[model samples]
Target chain A: MLALELGPVKGSAVLPTSSASGENAFRALFAAHYPFIWRQMRRLGVPESAVDDATQEVFIVAARRMSDIQPGAERSFLFGVARRVAADARRTRHARASAVSEPLGADTADEREDPEQALQGRRSQAMLHRVLDAMADDTREAFVLFELEELSRREIAELLGIPEGTAASRLRRAREEFMEIAGRMKATASRGAP
Target chain B: MKRLKDELPEESFEASLLAADAGGEPPEGPRRRALDAALRVVALGGGSALVAGKAAAAATAGAAATGGGGAAGATGAALAGWKILAVVAIVGGAAVGGAVAVTRTTDVAPSESATSSPSAPVPLARPEPAPPDTQSAAPPPMLAAPAPAPIHVDTPKVAVPSVPSTVPSSAPVFDLAGEVRAIDRARAALAGRDTGETLAALDDYDRRYPAGSLAREAAVLRVEALALRGDHAEAARRAQELLAASPEGPYRARLRKVIDGAAASSP
Candidate 1:
């Protein structure tokens, strides 16, 4: 079968020692940070239809710069890349309302059991993006790291390379803005603004 | 890092929205594509290292200020087709030599096809073009779609190439070389025009590295082998199935060629 013991990538003149290890590092980095990058793109105003492409753009940058990324700072480097990708996507793109493109064949029993809940989840997710999109990007980054990704305040500060006080204050401001915008959105939706 | 629900007294509108946000799972399809693209970059010996340096600096600078435009174009332009194929060929070459050395020492059977075949190895080399009706009339209903299906999806459950459980979701092992070797073995076999051997290499690849990073490459090679063996219809169907599943898949151009070639050659 495909399983074979992988020796060091030896005797490859085309692949320098640095790049071989870089490739290995790149794989591990991709595995670890892909979800974060994907979520960051979606939350940072990359429309749903474009999230995948955006995520690819982020990782492609990371892959190319694998050597420069310090061991502990991979997340920070990836976040930096993701921000630019999200920005680029938001700039050039038209708003395309995301369709429920769930893989029909792979629906788990849990998803099949509660279709309405699933739909509700989708709605809430869309709403959350709207509320987030209304916020400034810096505030949204702090909010995403803390609220959704569940990173500690110190970690968020480190990832964004800001003081803890700055990160916490940004998160606080983000929460206040979030509640305000979310309330307004609810009122508008209830009034049938669509 | 307490979730909003922990701080809030009750589940408010915003809290519910946050809850929904947490439930939103990132799709695996895109992740797989991203990985393939990244691996392609890595396999190219970090060809864009210089370009990425500039992009990274600009990205950081832009994040601090107003975001910059025009940074995305450089990396997109770097992903030319010949570079990718060169990476594949070089890595696959190294793998072929390595696999032979490892095969002698390892107890794993060299001929995976000698064991029970996963999908019956269709006698693709038959000279008589199997009547179209007869081919379609066969039992398993693979590729029932007028529209292409997703790459890792097996809707019919029977005919579709069994979507290996290891496609995505799990963190990939740091065996980029192993992935290259496994899929390259199949590529090498196909180079020899040994259809049976190519299919066997693929089966072995499927069995061993189900989650191997090069699963899509292996899938593409499988379609090519089928086509090479004169199983044009089967090749076309499988290519169509994979294309449907991953419209923007890595080997899209090659898969399109397989489908078009199959159509042109088939009765």
Candidate 2:
């Protein structure tokens, strides 16, 4: 249940035609979407180590189907491919380990006098990931697109092929769940428990 | 902690944390590697051999295809070796006479030899961005052909007609891809120290693209081939002619290297 951020492609709308134009257009597409795809793959539950491979897998699929993708729909097309790639990687990792190890745990209490200072940067990110990992896949996906990526509700609905109202409801549920869990975590950190 | 009050919206409450989470750009190393891999796979006609650790090979092949970035010493050498076969592919497909076909042949052929063979006898000699002087360089004296027909790569009427094999005799439309392949072959042949073959390839390029856009690249390769072939006097003369034309040309550094090499190697 990873999140996707499928921002609209900007400027160029050059579709693949001849080999030269096709290759050049592909380069433009790659430059525009590489970062978004990389972050999306990470949030989609792909482990850090396998993120590069998963990202490459998504583009490889894109390259093969470049001619078939409609010009304005490239972003959504790539997100769909990224979603499938993340799922495959997650399944593979799940099979390899009896219990999937959480990448960064937020349970360790900081020795620093200021608890808020301890959770500012990397720890904050880790806590976010933990909360994301705890939620149901669908809710997390909607939450991620809206809350983290700042993609509009309409975009998320189009990306997920769901009605706009459905996307809104899902985001609401995800927000409440996120707040409840984050509150509990904040309380635990303040208590200074190991 | 007050930021997370019961009434506060989740978006506003976590704005700081979300910014921390998503603010950074993706790591350049993985982005580069992933791009290199995608370019290689595409060049390979979407082959699934996308091996994880083959970044080095993919990087060279990627650079070659896109004409972007510099290849490392070893990869540059390998690219040089493949240049010979790349030229041969061009010569074989010479009758096709369009940039699209030439690009396809050049990219696919060189990539095949990209991995197993990693070095060649000749050193660096790549086509740089065409300077204004080079871009407007006159057609070669040897070409009896009329001025090149203007390429309409985007025109629906002439945009890669189905039968590429029949198009050349009527009108030779040279584009960047064809020019690149021609230069790559000449450069490769010269790198392999087969100056004779290099000159032959250049001659073919001249004939095919009399008013070629990459005349400057061809000129540079021709001079280098002559210098490497022990034709120091002719090489020096041609290099001087090029230098005199555009003293501040993009190929100035490369031409100086050629002159220095010619001077050092002459008896």
Candidate 3:
């Protein structure tokens, strides 16, 4: 069994489940993938307003399909769910396509890091989110998993359900697009500067 | 086309690639509430598509029954139910209009049909935070009548009276969920480090739900705000006091960290 640290949510307000072991497995699954799923939903362009619900929808879908999930396939499975959720979200509010993913709240966190670092981190995150949001869907998905998450091409291929060659091609396209968007972003930033 | 790829140093690009990921950080209060609400729904067997539908049958019926209560021909509940699994996913989040939605100007053209054209790239900055709307309950009435409401998941109120379908106007807005929204807004304020806004929001929260579920979260944030504003003595005192008050509190670690930080930073 993989040791997934559930952190604060291990026992926080656990709603009762029928099977003890099943609930344990579900919690383990939640522990393992909640953040990843949240991030993936944002990457796939679920607006922040709807992101919380979208993330929950993914998990609820997972809960309903819990039996179908293999042990190691959690993230990929969540990715698939995230994609569907994001698509629905975008369709519902195409205007929200330009929404910003808010920085994680610092209220509950350790503030050991300097406030300046935190601010810079937020800025970098904003830049990154913009660049990724501009890429075509397939390329963005592949690039996010492969480049940011550092999944192997074969792993990304498996996750995205494409041939490895297709995954590689998407990554290539994604990388070039990412750089182009990054360049444009930098140019845009420079232009906006007084 | 300026070869943006040419600008990326191999090693630097490798590092910066992951810089954007930031995947899997533990969620804070509002998000945690969302996750918890989802777990409650799923744990209650609302996870199945079939159950999600049955679970949302009332909301759907409420929408269909009412002519204008729902959006774009979609009632808030029905749209939420079918598209989002309803509050089974959005229970707590829905009440908090547009979970801090920040609209940024789009720099990239809608079409990525051609990559890397030398269109003068417009770098958009981060969106300014939403102006605090202390009294407004619904996200400033969406321009389009049918716009989907933000999902907010709260445990269903067993005691709240449900109006008949034909009379959808009688249904209450369920202000109980506002407590969560107040907490969420306070945190949003806290994130921007506006101590006054944070305090005022928390004060509003206190007035709204004196013995609310998120009191502890509010307290913790209050301490953080104090310290952030350089009231180290007050922050440390309050944190240590809160810690002593709830030695085994859920925020024990977080509280200790704040207390320690305040002490260390004291002049």
TM-score of chain A of 3: 0.70
lDDT tens digits, residues B178-250, model 2?
A: 4444655565565455778889989988887766645766787687677666777788789988988877554
- Name every residue pair that clashes in candidate 1: A1-B204, A2-B204, B148-B244, B149-B244, B149-B245, B150-B245, B151-B245
Native interface contacts kept by each candidate, as a fraction: 0.24, 0.13, 0.09
Off by over 4 Å in 2: A1-17, A93-115, A191-194, B1-16, B46-267
* Top-scoring candidate (DockQ): 1
The predictions' CA RMSDs to the true structure, in order, are: 17.6, 21.5, 22.0
lDDT of 1 by residue, B1-267 (tens): 566767875546666778777535578765775676565545443322222333343334323321222222233233222111111122222122121110011122212211111122221111123312232212111111001111111223322112322223231222333344455456556555577988998998788766544455677678878877888899889999877766644345556766877777867
RMSD of 2: 21.5
Please write out the lDDT profile of model 3 over residues A1-194, one tens digit for every residue: 10111111222123122223343455656665677677777777765545656676666556544433322344555667677667655554554323743223322134433322433455556556666766888888887776666666766665665667888878888877887776665544434422
What TM-score does each model's chain B reach against the true chain B? 0.40, 0.40, 0.38
lDDT of 3 by residue, B1-267 (tens): 122233566445323534545675645643455445434434433332222223233223323322221221222222221222111111111111111111122233211201111111211010113322221221111110000111222235221122211112221111223444565556556545567987898898777655543455567667767766777788778888877766644345555666777667766
Model 2, span A103-150: residue lDDT tens: 323344545323466456666776676677667778877877777666
DockQ of every candidate structure: 0.13, 0.06, 0.06
